[model samples]
Target: MMNMAQARPIAPNSPSQKQKLPAPRRGLHLSPHMVDVAVQVAVVAALAGIWEFGARFGALNPFLLPPLSVVLGRIWEDLIAGTVPVDLGLTLYRALLGFAIGAVIGIPAGILMARSNVVRWFLDPLVSIGFPMPKIAFLPIFILWFDIYDTSKIIMVAFSCFFPIVAATYAGCSSLDKWPIWSARSFGAGERELLWEVYLPMAMPQILTGLQVALPVGMITTIVTEMLMGGRGVGGAMIMAGRFADSVGVFAGIVQIIILGFVVVKSVEMIRRRILIWHPESRR
Candidate 1:
């Protein structure tokens, strides 16, 4: 045998005339997710630590700024013990019903305006005038018309949440990619089909954004109505606590309101993600 030559290793692909192996493309992984969760936990712990320190060391007065434990205890006593369930239930019921009512009118009204000059002309003045004014300003009118009852409160929330949604929906419809409409028309699509298949789907993101905005407004209006007029809800409880100067109870009510608000926001966000999973923000 001839003297053995040291073998040179050949690369999986040629060095000069190489076909790339894609550099081992990274897959979607959950490691970043775990890190994010850890970071969130740390943040919460830090905030809680600061709050505890402030409350315990007299940086804040116990009466004015009670410890989280005390506030939570009060929440347990009043809310978890059954005092809040009925009131919260009623408030939510009204809020849901009111939002549903607003959606029925606001969405269709917005579409009509976007699609028809006649509808826009009729509605423009009202929307412009009403959108900026606080719905609470109409509280007196609601009271007078519906009598300081659930009807008044429901109406108040419904109207408060309506315009923003209607406006957003209108914007969505008006801002559609014009080419799609032209194409659909050229392709012999009926007006109804075009509206249903093209406009509605394209407008869904804006429409949902409006609904998200409206949802919080609806809840807030309900609480404010309850607070101002006195009714069965966390807001009423807060008012009652203030009337009695029960600091712990007041704090508890405020906490409950905050928690409720958070839950509402989170729920909206979850629904938004599910519906608009294609949205970049939702995907992240």
Candidate 2:
């Protein structure tokens, strides 16, 4: 028979029992991502403050670097006047359409080049020569062949975007581990099955990287074409402002461009994260 003290259970709320349990997490705990975002926002806010104060205090020339408030006011005015929507729409349409065309053609061509010696032999020289050349120089030829409207601009953007996608895709597919291919072949996988199931999934990261590079190039080409063509886009608005010596309007257009680029780049990054959810990088 055990002694009464030895057999008895402790009280539920005893101090010793409380000490054995884990302490509740205390204070506000910020995630690394939240901290990073806060830092970025703070830096941008600081820069904007400097811009506003510097212009107001005469440290910066108002003509050259307008006050942040003035620029925001100008943008608001344009937004209310309804010109911004039309310009933004046209620019986005041309850039996105051109990028789509480039990707559709470039991805297949790259896969073929990687798979077939004949295709590689034919395209390698063209890619090598064309990649180094300033694609913008071909604008004159494009202009002569097509009109100076959206057609030429879209084609020019597509032309600029093609090389990066092809190079990235080819490299990704060619450098894949041979062991997987061998195993797939051993299991009686057809060429189409191997490509779809193995090659594309493995190479998707590189393909997405290529697309990220190409989108900026496409946007730049679109803007330059719009500027040269003098049409209804942010670039065209900037050029018009320059001709009329409306510095405020020019600055407003620049702000629009910056916002547009930021939105687009962030959107693409989000898409890449979604598409690459199974990738190691996405886990990080």
Candidate 3:
């Protein structure tokens, strides 16, 4: 009973049917992020290749700049001998301990300074003078007082880190929007509640930025302290290598420091992203 057009069963592979279905995707498609990562990797690889080949081909002096393989071999030897782990552990411990001490003391002082005029007046001069002055200048004094030990080293690092953290915290807390405070007050939020719920949460980004700045400074200070104190750390190892004119050992130490710094910095950035998930910058 159907008409001729309907009577003929439509082909399953007809043009109309084919048009309704999605076209088959061909080959690999890379996202922008993947492309960016590829570019970065390529750049690093190129630089490393240049370094390796230049030294191997005598374009670079073997004594001043040994081939990358030689440096890596030295590092491998240290790793196999178990000395690298101990030295790395000691350096990280001192740096992290000092950073913790600074953060613990600095955050509260910053908040207090922002909240109270009296505290600001009292601490302002000290922070101003201390922040600008080379913090390492006080190392000798610390050495005299605390001796050439972990105590002096840690204190020196903490001192270097404190100023940046406190400054960042104070700036963050003081430059807050008044509307949020007024709203919280109208809702009967107590001082403690306001501080915990409003102030810290709002100021966290700046505080984290300060921490990022302080961490590198702390590491630098730790290295200097280690070198001066002559202890079992990467800095000490580097100094010893220099004394013995061991360029390979010195370069190996440098590589270790670079790796340590890169790892810590990336870790901090990840932490910041996790903590500030709601922040606008985190979306980027």
Candidate 4:
């Protein structure tokens, strides 16, 4: 028989019998991302201030290194006149079009290479050779083949962006863990279902990273081609400004390029987050 004392229920308000639980601590918290953004803004502001002071006081050549104010004023004037917008639109169109083409080609090629030894063997050497060679060197050949119009420029941008996307995709595809594949197989998923539901989702983060890499390359290539070919782009505007020795115009063109690039990259990041909602890194 059990003792009455051992079997008795503890009184509800007895301090000695009750379990002690830790109270939840509450305090002010700051996000690391906020801190990072603050630091970056501070640094950029400091640099701009120094530059402005130098230019204003003639510590730097006003002709060669205009004040940030002068540059900003020129950018505003260009914006008001609609010149910047037209040039910016053309640049964006070419860059994005090239990027789209490259992405469509490169992603599938990368996946094929990852899945088939035959495809890998056939393409690996070409990728290896082309990846390191300066893509700009091929511009002359492309121009000769496709003429000095938008076609050549688009092709150049696509070529420059392709290697990065393919490399990133291939790396992502090959580096994927086998557990997801095994789990899908255990569930009796066929090859097509596994490709769509398992492998693609697992590879998506890396594929997005590849796209990110390719985007910047496409923009850069478009700018370089425009600068060389001299037509209908921010790069062409910059070239003309340089030719006229208009430092303010040159700087304004640069600012436009910076703005355009930032907007595009941020858009890509947003798309990446949406696509990778289930990914832990993407959430952060």
**Highest-scoring model, TM-score:** 2
Against the reference, the lDDT scores of all candidates come to 0.87, 0.93, 0.95, 0.91
lDDT of 1 at 68: 84
Local lDDT at 207 for model 1: 97
Which 10 residues in a row give candidate 2 its minimum summed lDDT?
Answer: 16-25
Give candidate 2 misplaced runs (Cα > 4 Å). 1-15, 19-22
Q: Candidate order by lDDT, highest to lowest?
A: 3, 2, 4, 1
Over 1-284, each residue of candidate 3 has an lDDT whose tens digit, in order, gives: 77898788768999887888987889999998799989988998898899899999999998999998999999999999999999999999999999999999999999999999999999989999999999999999999999788999999999999999999999999999999999999999999999999999999999999999999999999999888889899999999999999999999999999999999998999999999999999878
lDDT of 1 by residue, 39-117 (tens): 9889988977777789989998988888888888877776657887887788788888899899989999999999999
Clashing pairs in 1: none
| TM-score for each predicted model, relative to the true structure | 0.87, 0.93, 0.92, 0.88
Candidate numbers sorted by TM-score from highest down: 2, 3, 4, 1
Q: Write one digit per residue (lDDT tens) for candidate 2, span 228-257.
A: 889899889999999998888998988899
Cα deviation at 161, candidate 3, in Å, is: 0.7
Task: Count clashes in each candidate, considering only residues at least 3 apart in sequence or on different chains.
Answer: 0, 0, 0, 0
